[model samples]
Target: MRHLALISGADANHTLDALFVNAPLRDYGLRPRTNDYTLPVLGMAYIATYAQRAGFNVGVLDAEALGLGIEETAQIVNGMAPRWAAMNLLAPTYEMSARIADKLNPQIALMVGGHHAKAMPDRILADPRMRHLKALVLGEGELRVAALLEDMQRRRELPGVLWRDPLIGSRAGGVADPQTSGQMLGPDIDTLPYVNRAFLPQDPYRAAPTPADRRLAASRGSDWLTAGAAHGHLEANIVGSRGCPYNCTFCGAAFSANPDVKIRVRSPRNIIGELDSLHDQYGVTAFRFVDDLFLGAKRVIDDQMAAFTQHRIGERYVWDATGRINVLDRCTDQELGTLVANGLREVALGIESGSDRILTAMDKRIDAEMTERVARRLVAHGIGVKGYFILGFPGESQEDLDATVRHIRNLWAIADQHPGDIRASVFEFRPYPGTPVWQTLIKNGYNPDELLAYGDVDLTQDGADESMRQRDEFNFSVGIQFGGVPLDVVRGTLALLTREQHERNHSGQEAAA
Candidate 1:
C-alpha cells in the first residue's frame, strides 16, 4: 500500500500563519511577518517511519515549508497517486483541509489527525461537508497509522479508527453514528526510527526572528543585521518527550483531545543516536527540542546529561528547549551550569502571567515569585531566556495587567545586565477549543460558533473583549494585547520598556567600545 502524509499551507485569506505542531499555539497567525520558520512535524515523520517499516511505500509533504498553496499541494499529492493520505489537522486550518479534501480524488482514502481531530472527532466526522473524509486517528497516531493501513489492505474493520457508523441513517441531517475501533498509544518511542527528515525540503529553514534579535538590530543598526544574516547555520527540530504532565487550563495539549495522556520520552541514548546521524549526514549543529516539557524529572535530566557528556554531544551541537519555571527553579546552580556546558544555550519559559491570582485561575501552579526566582537563576547561569506572557484571561483585570507589566519590566531589567540574552513577547489570550478555559467560556454564555469561525483570525481580533475592536489598527511588531486597559496605556508601557532596553544597550555598547 502507498500512503502520503500532508501539511497544509496558509490559505490566501490568512494574512500570516505558522503552525507550532505542539498543541497550544498550534497555529500562530501574526502580522508584519518578522521571520519564516517551518518545523518538520515529528509526529508525521514518526508515522511515516512506522509505515515504511511495515513495508508500505510512504511519502511526506509539508505544504507550509514548501510554500505551496492548496492547489499546488493537491497537484503534488495527485501526482504521487497514493491509495491513502493522512493530514495533521489544527482548528485554524480546518476549512483549508476540507477544501483540499474536496479537490483530491474522492476514491483516495482520506484520514485526519492532530489536536482538532483528537479533541472533536465526532464533530469532524459528523459534518456532511466533510463527506470525503474516511477516518480519523485519535491521540498518538504512529501505531494507529500502521494498524489502519494493514486493516485497509485486508478489507477488515478498521481498528483505532473513527468513522461514521453504516447502521445510522440520515436521522439528523445525515450525521452518522460516530464510532471508534479503539485508541492506540505507541510503546517505547526509542523503538521507533528517527524522524525521516530526508523526506523534507532541503533548504535551511530560518527560525522566526526573536524579540531580542529585533531590539538588538534596531539599537545597533544594519551593520549588525548584515553580519547576523551572513552566518551559515542549520537548525533542526526534535521531540524528546510526548505529552505534558502538568495541566494548564488554557493549554490544548494538557487539557484538550488527549484522553490517554501518557508522557513518553525517548531514551537519552536514542536521542543522542539521532543527533549523531544528523551531524554526520546533514552537518546540522543547531537544534530545537520541541517537547512540551523537556525538564521533567531529575533522573531523566541526569541520564540525558550523562549520555550527552559520554557521547560528546556538546562538542557537535548547540540546542534549546521548552521548560517550566518550577523545574528550572528547583535545579541547583551547578546543574544549570552543567547544562550550559553541554550546549544548552537557551530555554523558553511559559511564564504566562505576572499576576499570581491570574496564574492560579489558569492553574499554572507556579506563582510570580517562582517565575522571578527561575528567571534570575537562568540568567545568572548565562543561559539565554525567552519569556512567553499572556495578556487576557476570563477574569483578568487592570490590576492583573499592571502586575504583568511590572513583571515584564523586572525581566527586562535582568536582561539589561546581559544584553541580547533575554527575549519576551506578550500575546493576547485566544480561547482555543477543547481547553478548560474555552469550555468555561462556553458555559458562561460565550458563543462557540463565533469562536470557531474566528479560527486563525482570532489572533488579530478579540471575540470576548468589545473594547479591542480598534486595537488591531496599530502595528506593534512586538506583541498583541486584549484587555479592559486602554490601548494607549498598553502601548505606552511597551514603549517605555523598549526605550529602557535601548538605553541600557547603548550604555553597554559604549562601555565595550
Candidate 2:
C-alpha cells in the first residue's frame, strides 16, 4: 500500500501554527507564544482519517511541536520514505517548506496545500523557489486529496490539482493560470470522519493560559482554578462548522479560497458523537471550538446546545469558542444562560476596535456601545469574555486612539463590577493579502511582491533589517497614531490606560482572594 506523510514546517519561533488548516497564520489573537501551547492540525487529522479509510497507510508529523528544525524535519521525512508526502504551507513558512522540499528525495511525490497555496496558487507555483512542489491542492483538502492520490496511482492528471508546467523554464515562467484545473469544494462536512486524534503524539497538547482577569474563570473560583491549571492538558480542538458568513475586511477566512462561500455545519448528533469519543477514548473533558464563527447561525447554536443538554455533554466537559459581538448580541439572555448552563465557559469576542470610526472603516458594522452591552451581558450570564482589539488602519488619528482607550476603561469598569469577567489584548493591524485592506495598502504604495519575497515571519514586523522585538515596539508605538496624534503621545496614552486597567484587575483579584 502507498503511504502518505502529512507534515507542518518547523517552528519559525516568531509565530504559532494555530488558525490555518494546512498552514500557520496568526488568527484570533493567537501569536507565537512565550509558553508551550500548540493547537493540533485539525485539517490534517481529517485528511489522515479519510486516507486511512481509502486503504492508504498514513503518518502525521508536526515538526514545530517536536522542536525539529527544517533540516532535521526533512531528514525524518527522508527516513519515513513514504511514496508520497505533503506539507502544509503558510506565507511566512513558505521558505521553510521549500527548504524542506529541497532536502527530500526528488522521486518522492510531493504536494503542497493550505491557506497560502489556496490563496496564491499561481504565485506559489510560478516562484522559482517553489519548483520542487509537484502539485498544489486548493481549498479544503480531504476529498481532493483522495482524488489526487488515486490519479497518481493511475498515472493521470486529476481535476482540482494544479501541476507545474513542464514546458516553461522555472525561472522565466509567468504566473500560471489558476484555472488550469477545476477545484471543487468538499462534500457535506457532516459526512466527513471525525479527526483521527489517535494519529497524534500521545503527549497532551498545551493551551495558552487563561488570564487571571477572565470573567468566568474569576467568578467560579475553585472550578476556574482547576480548569486553568489543566488548560491544555486534556484539551481537544473541534470544528462544529466551516466557513464564515461575515465579510470583515481583515479576515482571510471570511474571504476564503473556497469557491462556495456558504457556511456548513455538522449535525448536533455528529458533534455529540465526536465529543463522546473524545471523552471515552482520550479522557478529554476540555474543548476549543475552532470554528470561524461557532455562533454565526442562531439555529445551529440552539440545536447544538439542546443536543448537549440531551446527551449530558455539558455536565462532563467545559469548552470555549469564538464569536462576534453582533451575533452574541442577538441572542436573548435566556439563550445565553442556557449555553452557560451547558458548559460554555469562555468566549473570545472579535471586538476589533472600540472606536466607532475605526469600526466603521473596517466595515465591522457594530458600534462601541453595542460591544460593551454584549460583553457585559455575556459576563452576567457567567461566561468569560476576552475582547480582541486592533489598532492602526489606513486613516486613524489621536481622537480614534483616545476612543479606544476610553473603551478599554469601560472594559475595566465592567471587570471591576464582575471581577475576572474581562480580558483584552491589542494587536497592530497587519496587511494580510486577500483582504480589502491589503489592496488598499497596495494602492497606497505598499508593495505586495516585496512583502511576499520577505517570506512568512510575524506580520507585525518591519520587512527591513530589524529584530522582531524592535518591530513589535515600532508597531505598538505607531499603530494608533496619524495626523493629529503625535506618536509618543499615542503610545503614552495607551501605556497609561493599559497600566491602569492592569492595576484595577490586580486589586480586584487580591480582594477576591
Candidate 3:
C-alpha cells in the first residue's frame, strides 16, 4: 500500500503592508511580527503517529520548518505523489489553505482540519475553488484522518468526511460521536517518535526589509516574519505540555472544551534530556518554554527543578516562561530565587487588564491587586518580570481603558520601587477567530466583520510593521485594540514615554556624577 502524507500549515503572519506603508489598513503600532510558528502541530503530529500505528505509510510536511513556499511544497509533494495530501487550517488561514490546495496535482487528495472547519464546516465545503478537494476531516483530526485513511486503503465507506452530493447539495459521512469529537489519541510525550528533522527544508525562511524580497526568497503566499534579538542566540521554543487548564476569553475556542487533562507534562527527565540534547547536538543553549503557563504548578516546578539539578544541567542554559500572577503570588521568595538561580532569566505574567471589572468580564480569573502583588514579589527576588496587559474587552468603556492605563502605570511604579525587577508591556485586544471574545463580539453585535473577513490572511507579514520605525521604543505591542484610539495619538504617547525615560536616565547620571 502506498503511504499517505499529511501536510500541515501553521498560521502565518498577516499582511502589514496595508496597515503600515500602504494607505488602506489602519497603522497600529501595537502589531508585532510574531506569528504562530512555534506552536507544535500537536494535532497533526498525532495524526501522523496514529496513521503510522494503524499500518499505513505516513509522512508529515511542516512547511515553516521546511521553509517551502506553496509551489515548492506542491512540487515536493507532487514528486512524492502521496495518494492523499492533508492540510490543517486555522480560521485565519482558510484562504491560504484553499490557495495551497489549488497548487496540488489533481491526482493528490486535498484535505483540511482545524477550528474553522468545526465552527463553520459548510463555509469551507462550499468554496467553489476548494469544492473538488477530497475531504474535510471534522473534530480532532488524528483519529478521524487515521480511520479515514484506513477506510480509504480498503475502499471502505467513510462517514465523518464531508463530500458533495447532488441530491443533498452537500453531505458528511463517517462521523464518530461526541466521545470522539476533536480528540487526538496518542502516547505520552516520552512515547512519541523523535521529530524527523531530516524532513525539514534545508533553507530556513529569513524575514527581509521588503515584501518582494521575502517573497523572492520564499514563495507566494508565504509571509511569516521571523524576529530575534542581536546575539543570533535566540531561544529554542519548547513545550513541556500541550493543554492549558484555564479558558480565557481570548484563548482559542478549542481550548475551552474540557481539556484532555489539567495538564499533560513531559517528565522532568524527558524535558531536561531534550534540552541537553538540543545543546549538545543542535547547538541550542537558550530556551523559551512556550506553554500557556509554564510553572503552572508550584509542585511541578519544584519537581522539574530537582530533575534539572540531579542532571547538573541548570547552568548550561538560560530560559524564559509565562505563568499566572497568582502562581507567583503564592510562591515563596526562595522558590522564585531558586528558579532564577537555576536558569530562569526572565518571566512574563499575563495580567491582562488592571481593572477587576474588566478582568472578570474577560474571565482572566485574577485582578489588579493580584497583579501588583506578583510584580512586587518577583521584584523582591531580583528576578525580571515582564508584565503583560491588554487594553480592550467586550464591554470595556472609556473609563475601563483609562483604568487599565493607570494600572499599568502603577505596575511600573512598583517596578520603579525596585528597579530592574519588573517591566510593563501592553497589547491592544484583537478578536481572533478561535477565541471567546471573538464569539462575544459577534454576540454583542460589535461589528467584527472586517476582522473576520481578513480571518484567513496570515498574521505574519513579510516586513515588520512600519510603526516599528516611528519610535525609538514602544510599550504597547501585540494585539492592539482595533479602534477607539487614533494611531497618531498612540505613537505620540509612546514617543513621550521614550523621552521621559531618557530624561530620567540623564538626571540619574548627573546625581551619580
Candidate 4:
C-alpha cells in the first residue's frame, strides 16, 4: 500500500446557492463537460516527489486532467489503499475536493490544501463533509509535508504541525511554519526536485485517456496541449520561480495573500538541467513557464535571458513566460531583440486594466499606454502576446470600462498588422478569497461566506452565437453586482471582446482558455 496519494478532482464548485453555506451540489460525473484540457498538477507532483525521496511511498491521481468523476476517483484511491490522500483546492474546485474527502475510505487520513484551503481552514475542518481531513496544509507543501510525514511516522514532536487531535475541544487547524517560513522570500528554490512527469499523464497532458474524449477537444478546436503534440513541439510547463512580487489586488498571488510563501527562484543552471531532463526523458521540446513572475522585473529577466543565451537554448527550443508591461516597456530594443533571437516565442502579460486610474487601483504599475506600447513592440519583434484583462472590479467606473474596451480594440488592431500573435483574454472580476479586494469587501460589511459563495457560471447560453464560442470555458464569475457597472454592459463588453477573439481564432490564430 502506498503511504500517500495526492488527487486533483473535477471542478464541481458547490459554493453558490445557499445564502451562507454550501448546498449539496450536482453529481460529479454529471457536471457539464468542457472542451478545455488542463496541464499537470505540478503542486501534487512536487509534494509526491519530495515525500517519495524522503522514503515515503507516494502516488498521485489527477482526476481533473484524467476527467474522472468523484466516485471513480475515490474508487481508485480506495484501491490504492494509501495511508493518506490529499487534494489541492482552488475556489472553483473546493466542492469536489470536499465530496471526494467524504467518499474516501475512512482509514485513509485526508489532508486538504492549496490557497483556497488556507483561506478557509477552520470552515473546512468544521464542515461535516470534511470531517475526514486529518490536516490542512497552509502554504508551500513540498518541504512542509515531507517533514510532517517523517515526524508522524517516527512519532516525534511535529516540527510544523500546529494542530492535532481533531476530537479536542479547541479544534485548532495545523500550520506548517518553520525557519524557512520566516524567510518569506529567501528559500533556495534550486533545492527542490524537478517535478516528476510520470506522476501525471504526459503525451497530450495525459488528458485524453480514451478516443471519445479526444473527440471532445477536437470538436472545440484542439486543446493547447495538442499544439505541443505537433512534430518536435511536445511541450511541458516549467516554473523558474515561486510567488509574485507585484501587488495586483484582484489576484490571489498578490504578496498580501501569501504571507508564508517564500519567494524563490531556481538558478539558471538548475532550470536548464530540468529542461535537459524533460527533453531526454519525455521528449519535450517546447516549454512554458507557469511562474507568476517569470519575467517579473528587469534584473531578474536579464539573468534568466543571459542563462538562456549562454546555453544557446534557443538554437533548438522555444519557450514562453509571463512578463510585466512596465519592465518590458523599459527594455531596450537590443535587449528585447536578444530575447527574440533566443527563441522567446511569446510573453503572457498581466495587462490588468486600460484606464490609468483603474490600473493604479489594481496595483498594476503600468498604464494603458505602456500596455499598448509593449504589445506593439512585442508583436513587431515577432513574439506572440497574450494580454490578460479583468473587468467589473469593485467600484470600477464607466470610464474604466470604456477605456478597457478601446484598449482591447487597439491591441487587436496591432495584432492584425504583425507576424506575431496577440490575444486578449478578458475575465469578469469575481471576488477571490484572500485577495485585497476580498479583505476590502469584508471591511465594508461583506460576509466572508458571501464572498466565497460564487459557483461556476455558464455565460455561453446561445449555441448560435458565433462570437467567442469558448467564453463559457473561461468564465469564472457569479454575476455579483460588486460594481456599479451594469451586468449587461460588462457582458456586452465581454461579448465584443470574445467575438473579436473568436474571429481571430476562426482565421487560424491561437486562442487562450
Between candidates 3 and 4, the TM-score winner: 4
In order of listing, the candidates' clash counts read 0, 5, 22, 1
lDDT of each: 0.62, 0.63, 0.54, 0.68
List, residue by residue over 1-513, the lDDT tens digit for candidate 2: 111234332222322111112222222123432223455677777777777676566667765544446655666667656667788886656666777777877666777787777677777787765656666776677766766566653223444457676676442222323453323454688888877775555323555444432434455555634665445337788898878777777777755334455578888899888888887886776787989667766777888888888887655777888887887889998899788767787888788777788898788879999989988888766678777776655577767877887887797678657523777755555555676665666677766665455322333222222223322322322132323656445444444544554555566557554
lDDT at 365 for candidate 1? Answer: 82
What clash pairs does model 1 have?
none
Residue 407 miss distance in model 2 (angstroms): 1.9
Identify the superior model by TM-score, candidate 1 or candidate 4. Answer: 4
Error of 1 at 313 (Å): 2.4
Q: Relative to the unseen true structure, what is the Cα RMSD of model 4?
A: 7.6
TM-score of each: 0.77, 0.78, 0.68, 0.85
Model 3 stretches astray by more than 4 angstroms: 1-82, 138-169, 175-187, 198-234, 253-262, 416-425, 446-451, 455-513
Model 4 lDDT per residue over 268-384, tens place: 899999988988887666688988767877888788889989998866566789898888998999988888766677799988778899888888888888888889898887788
RMSD of model 3, in Å? 10.7
Worst 10 residues of 3 by lDDT: 15-24
Segments of candidate 2 deviating more than 4 angstroms: 1-34, 153-157, 169-184, 202-233, 256-259, 453-513
Please provide, for model 1 over 218-276, each residue's C-alpha lDDT reduced to its tens digit, 9 standing for 90 to 100: 44455433233244346688889887777788888873435677678888888888887
